[model samples]
Target: MQPSHRYTRLTAIALGIAGVISFGSAGATGFQIRENSVKNQGRAFAGSATGQDDASVVSNNPAAMVNLDTTTIRTDVTLIDLTAKFKGGGRSGAGTPLTGGNGGDPGDATPVPAMSIVVPLHGAFEKLTLGAQLSAPFGLKTEYDSTWVGRYNAIESEVKTIDLTLSAAVKITDRFSVGAGFVYERAEATLTNAVDFGSGICANPQTRPLCLTPNPTAAAFGPQKNDGLAKVKGDDTGIGWILGFQWKPTDALSIGYSHRSEIDHDLAGNITFTKPGNVAAVFAAGGVTTYNNGPGGAALTTPSTDTVSVTYAFNDQFRMMFDAQQTDWHSLQSVDIKRANGNLITSEKFEWDDTMMYALGAEYDFSDSFTLRGGVAKDESPTNDTHRTPRLPDNDRMLYSVGLTWNANEHLSVDAAYTRITIDSPDVDVVSSSSSTLVGKFKGHADLFGIAAQYKF
Candidate 1:
């Protein structure tokens, strides 16, 4: 009785709030978006660590800063056309009339931005370089109809993050350079879901009285109108670091390696509960509650990462690139929430696996002023079917892209790129920890377009 009844409405409410503050899955892979640099977006991020064509590499390999010609500044934006939808069977406990319509397309067109700069030091420090950047490395957004079928499981969810970086690098020799950086990051999120006050019946089984919100004498069963609202908001700031090396074994061959440290944050916020007037009357009469005080807190750690890349020029006019990266997503094992007084609210498990991404790309020099880029990649998601939730039903994906760089003059250049993404169908069925049962499959794909301008002085 303890285990089965333990999953009552309380379980669902807790799970929903947990997913909000710790949104681990983004439109990309496992809540991690790689659209940080526009120049790299065009290359499908193939030479992320090894390619030093521009100041953009600062985000992936601080050491690559030495590859810049002089003082350089770059700014870019990526417009994402992404979405996820559920279509299939969804129901309440057998007897309920599976109220609410299937959640329609719950994705939106969002824009991501990034900026970076690199400067070379001469004279006393002739071979040294300095760089800085501001960008968003992780994020997510999903909004369903307030009364969608999965409302009890999840309704609206949004997460946003930004990072500020500072670093320096030294050129040990013409062929070898190493660099490192420090980062300050911040994250915030909002999650909303429906609460089933009717589950109050499970609070104290011995009494066997149906508990809605305000009073039990009103009826033996809970009313659809009795469903209440639950919303949670949390935000935090933390710090991390990145180290990298760029090596040129031969004039035409370059290899780069980089590692990023993990960031830990403790988000402090409050959960707000709203129940129908009648349901409140019932819960008060029974001395029961779906939740204690609204104030809450959660502890979380963003994953660390490693990337290796190589760029080999076949000839003066053509070059090939390859990149492989691994993220320690396994670090996210569970999420625990505590009230203002330190009492436990709930602890939920994520059982995620580490993930990897592989990419291959090529660059062609059409002339001294024009270049073309194309690439493809396979990216894996950390979440599986069983754990996939309404907030984000993520899965493995394939990316195909094309881009071009036009040097209008010695001081100005423009970069443009387009990508088509295919996401493997994932089951969005989360049964064990939600306030309500939600099951279905999401057939999804996305299109990303990016553009950037660079100036050299």
Candidate 2:
């Protein structure tokens, strides 16, 4: 027999009852990834607003490109390893028997890559220069076992984003320069979590608080739970801008400042949720045989960033660089997803505060062909204890890094760097969809290794 109209409507409502949230911690605040450029990673990104070594400066301070006279192309890749382990006394606030072990280590390895090109102009353009950069500016992938104690809170989250920048700089005088750029970015996300069938119908906005009473259909799946998967993926192109200024007060000191604007996106996609066969049968009998929904809706605004840096060359062999950056994470207060019907799917309250990051780096030139680099940095987390979730157990971090550069030839150079990051333990106390709560502590550490090659044309 064909599915009834009531059953079809129910299914569609179920599908539209949820939306999406995909985020992970990378640096500064939220899941903003900053490891795309290796040469910058070597110095913990310390003089990034000014420069490190190659055309990649276009990603940070385009004005710095005026100092580079060569037509160059550079590419870099980083292998990042993250280890996050949760350990603590876990209890269910729902006052029910727990399911499985505290989520095991939820961290994994991922690779980030980037490329940029810079060309100096002469004659008509004289002191003006042009450059472009392509890189992953935000990303995250964290997964947990399906049966983990906090599975209902989160099972997995994967997010990917890319930023492309077209930039130009003009040297107004021998001592000063200014630059600006237009940026285009795209982002996609996928997330999953278990369903608490035991608690009643999921608390979707369209339904009454007690929509799923102790009915025959609701009783079919009792006590235990139903496995649910939520997949919401979409792509949107957003526009932003970047501005930078560079100053050379004297020959030995250089100062640079840069600002990157925020981009907002109203992502359009499809949201699908699947349940076990037994639960499906119950839903089918209750006029929810199949799920249906129009385009799903998710929205987010990547934060704006500002950086100031100073580089001092005490002598020809040694140099020091220090940098400070501020991220306006407050712009991202919460993530509330809705379906086409304007019903809520899910909501995340971050109420995040602004963040500040500082870095100090030093470089020593052993010879014209060889150099050594080292740096230390501190990064603050935007999430507070009360709002921290298992999916993003982020905390303040300390970083140490070392690297070296070899000028293989006048036209070629290679750079390699390694960094160790440590974070203070953070407590994870998140409530699940079924109204149960999972509480614990999470500890984490990360390692970053990168290599880059630069060719001067």
Candidate 3:
């Protein structure tokens, strides 16, 4: 087979595999990271300063650890259910006619799992508090069935990430405190999908002649079927830091602020392709069969970013929190491919931009043992019309949530919350080098559910 043919087949297989690993099996929304204190949720994530109960406070603001008054150990676990539905155009030829079809299998659900722990240290230190934490703050998965209309575009993707943090808080005065921490994070991803070039383009008279070459295999197999799967795997790690402060102006009021730095991760993975017997038969007859172990894998990396937040309290009856976050998505502009032989295959450019997210929440204390919370937030999408792919058909989204905290006793507390998210389909256009016409007008939507628990020592 010609180099171009080998390249095309390999590309399809790689994309299919990456699609399955990164999106097909992965949830639509990446992993989620929320502040630790039950009171922080009421302000919509505003608790960078006033967090006192759970380890999440280490991520929100380490200074708040000084308020615990005791060597406290806390842990929280959350479970999320996500549903994504696709709508709009289906499979189509380059120039003839277009059809509306759905991608992915029916009744697919993505589950998100998260856990965190915070520990405070004492003994030799009278004014210092030490803490540690572990949790997943970012990642996502999206996948469709093989028969779906958009199968040629994407199939499935699964991505996961985790972070570990160590921190120290010090009381500078009777009412002032400060804290800082070192952060280490790790991430992994897998994607898979099928590539359909034969039926998609070879059947069209106008496009067929241009993509086909004289082949004995095509005659033996009675025509070739351009269908195959590709898979990509990757992993990487990085380091960052955090800083925060807290002030208690009076016995009845307190304020806090904190910032967590972003850490960059570089993922290294391999891509593989498998061809069916029928397709290989066609290539064999045409004397056009060729295969490389697989395309040289690439190194994928996403930039680290920062979040800042504040919290305020009035007596023990009421509290409010506000937060803002920035993500350096601009780093995703391209995926560069480098071969072990020191050859540069090609680069996939994705023109994404930096985004900001904001939220607010409030809490009401009904009694010494009971607290109620509610909040709202807005999240931004990282893809644009030109770069959008089936693996992550996302858009700006809005969230609303409510929860309750029950203090089982002085050291044990249980917290539960539910949130609903909604996003409108983004307008996009799809095209391929092997086809004659361009495809357009795709849309979809998704929903989410979550729950969590905490214990303090």
Best by TM-score: 1
Evaluated against the true structure, the overall lDDT of model 3 is: 0.58
TM-scores, in order shown? Answer: 0.92, 0.89, 0.82
User: What is the TM-score (0 to 1) of candidate 2?
Assistant: 0.89
What local lDDT does model 2 show for residue 432? 54
Q: Using TM-score, rank the candidates from best to worst.
A: 1, 2, 3
Show the lowest summed lDDT stretch of 10 residues, model 2. Answer: 11-20
lDDT of 1 at 148: 81
Flag regions of model 2 displaced more than 4 Å.
Answer: 1-22, 89-94, 201-220, 288-294, 345-347
lDDT of each: 0.77, 0.74, 0.58
lDDT string for model 2 (1-457, tens) is: 2232222222211221121222465443467778767777888878887784678879689999998887999999888777888765443422556678767777777888899999999898888999999988877778888788876667777777889999999999988999999999987766666665433343332222323565745544333355555445566889999999999999989999999999988776765666677656655666652344256676778889999999999999998899899988898777766676677655656788888889999899999999998999999888787877777678889888898999999999999999888988888776555556777898788888899999997
Candidate 1 local lDDT, 1-457, one digit each (tens): 1212553436333645577533543336887878867667777879989756677677789989988969999998888877667775565542254478777877778788889899999999989999898888887677788878777777788777898988798999999999999999998878887765554443445433453436645655452445677787888999999999999999999999999999998877877877677656655775664454466777878889999999999999899899999999898877786776776767777888999999999999999899999999999988877677777767899999899999999999999999888889888766533345677787888889999998999
Ranked candidates, highest lDDT first: 1, 2, 3
Report residue 226 deviation for candidate 3 (angstroms).
2.9
Better of 1 and 3 by TM-score: 1
Winner by lDDT:
1
Q: Any runs in candidate 1 off by more than 4 Å, and if so which?
A: 1-13, 21-27, 93-97, 199-223, 289-293, 432-435
